[model samples]
Target: MIKSLDIVSDLGEGFGSYQIADDDSLLQIVSSANIACGFHAGDPRTMASTVQKCIANNVAIGAHPSFPDRVGFGRRGMDLSALEVETDMLYQIGALNGFAQAFGTKLQHVTPHGKLGNYVVEDSKYANAVAEAIAKFDDSLIIVTLPGELAEAAKKKGLRIAYTIFADRAYNTDGSLVSRNQPGAVLHDIDLITSRVLRMVNEGKVTSITGQDITVKGSSLLLHGDTAGSVQMATKIRDSLIANGIIIKSLNATK
Candidate 1:
């Protein structure tokens, strides 16, 4: 069972403008902020502001890089080559790092967002490409992926990996995320989610949608910062962990 999680708040493109929801969410919970960069979402202003906010809040800042499709909000998969992904990863991370530099800080990690990440998880070829991208950018920058797949790919390429498990979503036996279109994909029931998460932490496994036990090495548990009632869920998760004698800390510290 994994404990002492490094929780992240993914701020897709909701940074500068209409920041109320995000700002309020950040204030309550979140130890890390995965700020989007132009491709999937976010603009110059939003990126700058988001980095600043994370710095002010002492939250570890990261680049939430994604496919080049803002219209689809990076949820739609793109047919991009390895070179393209490599270049895009460099561009997004560099952009975020530049903005973080404005505040005399540096990005702590890189979490690939939405469709691109999904594609890589399903394709070993693409996973290799993604690993190449991260390795080129900075081998020290932790590659945040769905743990099993990309983590193995990144580790083989000599890059540090964070086994990122979603606190708001369910998993499948294949170790892929259950499609959002499915009935049990997203858990709105806080009690159910809490129980599931606690079970995973205390048991080192998540029962898949098909009832098979999937081995999970959860170094970081992600709480979707954009979901409705997300704040309440995060609060419950944090407090419940403490009450149960589980610690809330960084994955970096754990490793």
Candidate 2:
């Protein structure tokens, strides 16, 4: 049984006046914040502000890099070369790291956002590109990803890996996330979400969409901040974990 774990959320996804979620409230609950870098759904102001909030809440900061697909919110796949992937990852990480340094902290981890995130899991080239970027930028940075190519690449680069499990997403039998376009891909039931988290932490098992029981030993639990009622769901999951004698901490602390 897992005694401790990190709870992370994708935050700072709003651009200008177009806000997505209640980030301030989320900071109070999550142990880590994956702040977006301009490419997907954030700007300079948002990154800085989110980093400041994370510092205040004692939450770890992580870069959430994505393809240059603001219109698609980084969910749609792009046909970029390996060099493009590497450079984009570096650019995004550097931007967030600057803000993190200014805020009296450094980035603790990196998690690819949206389609890029999915691609890296299966595509060796994308995975290696991302790993190369992180290793060049900061080899000490932990890579938050599922168990796949990205994880292997991080290991090869001698970087730390934090296997993450999604609290609100459905998984396929092959351990990939169900497409958002599919029905029931994103879960909204608080009771169900909390229960799944509990089982994942304590039992290292989750029932996939295909009704197959899959093993998942995750060091962190990912919660999406932009989903409806997400704050409440996060709060409930946090409380449930604590009440069950599971410790909630930042990824850095866990490491």
List pairs with backbone clashes in candidate 1.
Answer: none
TM-score of each: 0.92, 0.98
Name the TM-score of candidate 1.
0.92
What are the lDDT scores of the predictions, listed in order? 0.78, 0.94
lDDT of 2 by residue, 133-249 (tens): 999999999999999999999888789999999999999998899999999899999999999999999999999998999998898899999889999999999999999999999
Q: What does candidate 1's lDDT look like per residue over 138-197, in tens digits?
A: 788888888555767887888877778778888888778988778988878888778777
Of candidate 2, the 10-residue stretch with the lowest lDDT total is 246-255
lDDT of 2 at 145: 95
